[model samples]
Target: MSPNPWWQDRVVYQIYPRSFCDSDGDGIGDLRGITSKLDHLQALGVGVVWLSPIYRSPNDDNGYDISDYREIMPEFGTMADFDEMLAAMHARGLRLVMDLVVNHSSDEHPWFQAARTSRDHPLHDHYIWREPGPDGAPPTNWEAAFNGSAWEWNEPTGEYYLHMFSRKQPDLNWENPALRQEIWALMRFWLDKGVDGFRMDVINMISKPWRADGSLPDAPVVREGFLQPAFAMVCNGPRLGEFLQEMRREVLDHHDTLTVGEAPLATIAQGIELTHARGGALDMLFQFEHMDLDSVGGHVNGKWALKPLDLRDLKQTMNRWQQALHGQGWNSLYLSNHDQPRPVSRFGDDGRWRVESAKMLATWLHLHQGTPYVYQGEELGMGNVAFDDIHDYRDIETLNHHRVATTERGQDPAEVMASIHAKGRDNARTPMPWSAGPKAGFTTGEPWLRLHPDHDSVNAQRARADPDSVFHHYRRLIELRRQHPIIVHGRFDLVLAEHPLIYAWTRTLGDERWLVACNFSGDTPVFECPAELAGREARLVIGNLRAGAGERVDDLQALVLRPWEAVVLRLLD
Candidate 1:
């Protein structure tokens, strides 16, 4: 409604610390490494950098299980290094957004240690603790996101602690006002230290109160092959809005900072209510509906079919969000993040035609109506890493799922492995392909993890030299979005929704109108332009191939598109 907000025009880059760059030659990425790369990030036109968890941790969940929220992890350097990184980022006109994992804390944290020491201790109430059932088993049938039961037996306390994730990371008791205040104080500390904002980790899950009665307030939905119904009950609870609003009032709203919640399960209605401009809660939230586009089913453990999306479905999904949040909230749009597989490998053709297909995918998504987020190595058209051995894995969730499907669930190991092959963390977490050198130039040693073998051919060094590479295409895309006001503030409208392979939309802001069309299928698709968009002259702004200028499809005329080809047109009155 108003002029596009600063965030809408900016490109946010996600950096997973461990695999980004190793400064000290220890095979682990650190703050100094990120500081050293500020110029490269700035050159790419990134306005904000979202760093994954770098807080003090046991590395059980690779920094997600924070032991100390106030301190940086030793492996990632000290708080001083972080401060220096922040200053350097500011010098480059880039903002730093740190991960805030308030939903849980590492078991080794002082609060958890004190809680385990004595039942009467003041810190004992900081985390969720419930009495065991009559059979001395877990209090409820709630399942952990990784695998089996959510509750872990605590012998010292003679009770079970709630861990929606790994056992080493216990969920905090947000129902306790004192604990909530402490979290607020931590937020204030970070903001005082010059953090632009926070990328809230599982921020919605922090709302659930531990009920000793083992009965969730809302009924659970148990779909076929779907195990975690507790996710629905715990995520986005009744008190979620209240908690987020308090957070905004105490920390984010004060500085007018950017706060994007990692709220994958939140509905569009909930997102609008929480992120509306009138200081509802967050600036935006990441939804996984489109991110999970190629999956075989909605279930995480199922095999991925690599199915190309029906253009109509993609258009409807985007239209639903755009229409819902038109004037109320904002959007954080992305194709690849740390937890998911690489976009090019899963969505685009990454074999012989990697560069072309990758660029096409970039054009189709980044030019849409939302703030763009580029995960590390996405610029290089990086694909999923292939691993033949179990030792090649570094992610805890992947390992746990492997064990569950093969051991407990009694499924064929090959079939389980096939699912993992299609979708695995190694897809997004492989070492950044900096150059065609030892360790893909990510490290001098044997790397903390396996580097994708294709790094030799798909490194940034080569992409930077090629004008047609996906990396350069991203640069052009960012520049175009940054310079165009209408693309940022314009209203989104779906133009053609009946075709299964042709997705077309238009953006209108004042006198400027731009039409974007894409072919989601591998075969060429055609669509007839609506009468409302019929015009005598429309110039081709951009396309997958150099179709040249002055190409116009008048209203009522059918336009044909090659497989995976996308185009943008400028309407001239």
Candidate 2:
């Protein structure tokens, strides 16, 4: 048997620091606030904590537009506070993973400032700069992820700089060897500080592809505004593997750490090459294929417009990834994060059956053959917020999209607001509810953003007090993974693949097999054992509902499942 890496079986919990907890009673959460919550995470059975960006920033993109890579954001805390937090996490046997956002930097960063000062400056080539077109417009029709043109003019330098997200964030030029070395040194700085790993933001977009003549080309127009989809040229470029392997050799080989790259447009073949043990590229990748299930018109439509999710598409996408990387690579499983809306609101029912649906979603994701990630408030089954007014929104991307849709595209404001309410990132940015207090027990002062109105009934304190709460259900699921080797190493086989309301699968290891069945809808359904599983004796392991003595199955048979119910059973010969 091969040696097991520390991360293979570990459950990772992601904390959006700005909304996790507030220590100084201020409106924002800080490193010290996270330190205070270590016990909560430990009790939840999480072995690793993956924090979103906490680096110094101008708040243009909520910490993604980093101004200083080595300094902590003043709003969060001082450098000493970060050190103290790291020490506290270590003492509690929890590893820390920092966000690495080297794809771009804040315009206020010294390098970008110098680059903008003059074309003769030594750092002028540090970022992607190009002269305006002969028509005095942008060099290309490439559209930004946030709605406008990707290129922003710098008056002083008489050149346009590329920004994939926001104008305040200027994309770096990875073609420069000096910049690569600088990034490697920065990685070394964090490793020396004892960080266990990095979650690289848009890491796959570092290596951009240029034309054979060394000139940038215009992308194919996909929208009415000549908004070309630039991701095709920007993501998983030709030299991405080369750059990742080089970084691994120069910086990562020296430290015993984990690295997961956020590759938005990467394919399964690319994922295999990036994470295969012998590939020397990365440990794993967060692919977005499954996340785009509700997206229409492919990548051009983005996530604003929603479509009814097809269960067949979902199953095929997941099964492909699991089977492709069964032995050669690893997978990172997640349902929601800072960039997504609440899973219960987007995927499961958040109304009358919130608790039951949340538990079912957790069971479905955690039982998959991969390392599981639990976002903040996920264990408590927090639902999405319903902000009626546009002024209540704080996310830059949401605001930009609203403006572009209503003002430029002539879309109705009410219709745009409806989409925003359903899929906006702000839904996930609300302050975490620790208790049923005035401000959700997140801050003594007014929160930076509004708290969810339903926090009174769905807070962490309330869940911990109830033995049958969603929090306890998640804890039990985590514990099950640790106790059963089949869950971590067994081969996966999809069962009831075409079922519209039920998701069922089985994991087999040597002579033992575990069967998992989940009902996703609010209606009761009868689930029949598959032909291969017929005539096999089974023992109930864990489930959301109690199995009475009269209802227990002594032989292979069909079972009536309640709304949003999930069950795990062990097959005994």
Candidate 3:
């Protein structure tokens, strides 16, 4: 058997294709645009590039609504372009992992089209369809992830179909054996092309709650009249484990693949079971427990209901995962993704302490025991865009929320806009600021979405030139991980667990030990070294402070840290 997949210790960089770079002058990013940026990935020291969906799509839900499983999106380029891109990645010693969105398919897809045309169609059972209730209401009071009802009426079929996301993206019926076979075939199609693996989008949501009598249970009402979120009604359903295991046997077991499942709302024990090496379904899991800390009632209020990030709460969450997954499975570490706002804006200070805070966040994430994911533009200390106009936003989720909040709920538009500015997914979808030129050099033509106004100050061209840029700090962090085996296989223990602003942790492997500490605020904070490490000789392996990349100290009893200052010290015992 393979000792461990190469992706175990490699850092994965996620590229949101549409906003990464636009090479065709069509104002949209394509395969050629991504190929042009291979050198950047190589220099950044990331081993794997997780390319977002480029499959044939209708652009509804921005390529997540896949219409054709085997073809590339015309706007993104052709099948030939995909092949060339893959070859270029391999030549540079970089592995490519494609996003696997099997939970749903575009309404325009042949199967969905045929399924919706008539109730007697052979493909009708390929999707989940249900007769309306006696009052002509939807089958269940289940809300889609984006907004509105989870069930959409099919006029021709005289029934409503399930859509956990947008109406155009209908959820697939996994209970069908034929559907499973077809999915397995598509998996082979890409793996045969030599791509590394898959990042299953909402993989746990495939096996939704289906009763023995063929009825989907109604979601519990959070409020009196609103259609409640179907998070519990559909997510992590009974057959999730069985389906994943079947997928492994049919597709993953045949290839040396790297599988990371997006398992929202999963507990630590569930994560461990899903990613177990022997009988498990995936190699890693993206848990949202840490991401949910700031949101009070996330499923009910959506992500817009924001709260301040408590360093102590963050420490507890991370410590639990790190300590639990030490030997059972692996963690997929990330601060933000394509569907979330920039980390600098959310977790770190994006204004007064931008670069320092970005570097500090990177240090905090990479210092732990997990495969770190660098979303596109994250390494450059990019922050959220201040799009004052709702027209400037492009995400369906954001637009839907604005409509519901203002028109339906009678909410103040300005207050709603503030929430959008804080938690909008469009914040992460801004065009990559490659240079401080017109359109930030992302495109020679008009960009599909408005570029961040601050792109002039924060761009890759400038960050790469300055040694103190967050880009270089990330490079150093990745380099350290590659060089030190302890960083990958070490056990983590939280220090100063109760500190409100000072987040500190230690990693140990046999006789080797390393201390990592960071001040999460603008105020200077002192990290009183732990008793075991106090008075021990230590060298600053890497730091975000202005002048301490390799400084040494004989005694480590107490050290003052600047605002957002982060330090990694190799305890010389």
Estimate, for each residue in 1-573, the C-alpha lDDT of model 1 and write its tens digit.
Answer: 224456778999999999998888888888998888777788688899999999999999999999999989998999999999999999888988889998999999999999987778999989888888778978777777776778898888898888988889999988888999999999889889888888999888987754566444433445675554556558887688988877767766578477899985788988888878775678889876776555555544333334555656667777899888977888778888898888777777778657667777888777677788999998888888768876789889789888877788797888767667668877788888788988877877767888888889888788888877778778878888878888777898887778776778888899888888876656766657788876545778777765544676565256677767778888878
Model 1, backbone clash pairs (residues 3+ apart or across chains), number: 0
Instruction: Report lDDT per candidate.
Output: 0.80, 0.88, 0.90
> What lDDT tens digits, residue by residue, belong to model 3 across residues 1-573?
244667867999999999998888988998999999899999899999998899999987999999999999998999999999999999998999999999999999999989999989999989999999979999988888888888999999899999999999999999998998989999999999999999999988999888889998987767776455776577798989999889989999989888899987888999899987667789999999888788867556667888888888899999999999998888889999999889999999999999999999999999999899999999999999878899988899999999999999999999899989988999999999999988898999999999988999899989989988999999999998988988898999999999899999888999999889888999988777778776788888999985765688677766888999998988886
Q: After superposition on all CA atoms, how large is the RMSD of candidate 2?
A: 1.8
Query: By lDDT, highest first, what's the ranking?
Result: 3, 2, 1
Greater TM-score among 2 and 3 belongs to: 3
- List clash counts for every candidate, in order: 0, 0, 0
Give the lowest summed-lDDT range of ten residues in model 2.
547-556
Compared with the true structure, what per-residue lDDT tens digits does model 2 show for residues 1-573? 124678887889999999999989889988888988889998899888999999999999999999999999998999899999999999998999999999899999999999999999989888999889998799887888887888999999898999988999999999888889989999999899999999999998888778786667788766665444776669998788888888989998888887899999888999888988776478889998889998776577788777877777788899889888877788889999999889999889999999999999998999989889999999999988879888999999899999989888999898889889878999988999999987888988889899999999999999999998999889988988888888888888888888888888898889999888898888888887788888877778778775421234566566778999988888877
**Model 3 CA deviation exceeding 4 Å by range:** 1-3, 223-228, 546-549
Assess candidate 1 and give its TM-score to the true structure.
0.94
Candidate 1: where are CA atoms >4 Å away? 1-4, 209-228, 296-308, 547-558
RMSD for each model, in Å, please? 2.4, 1.8, 1.3
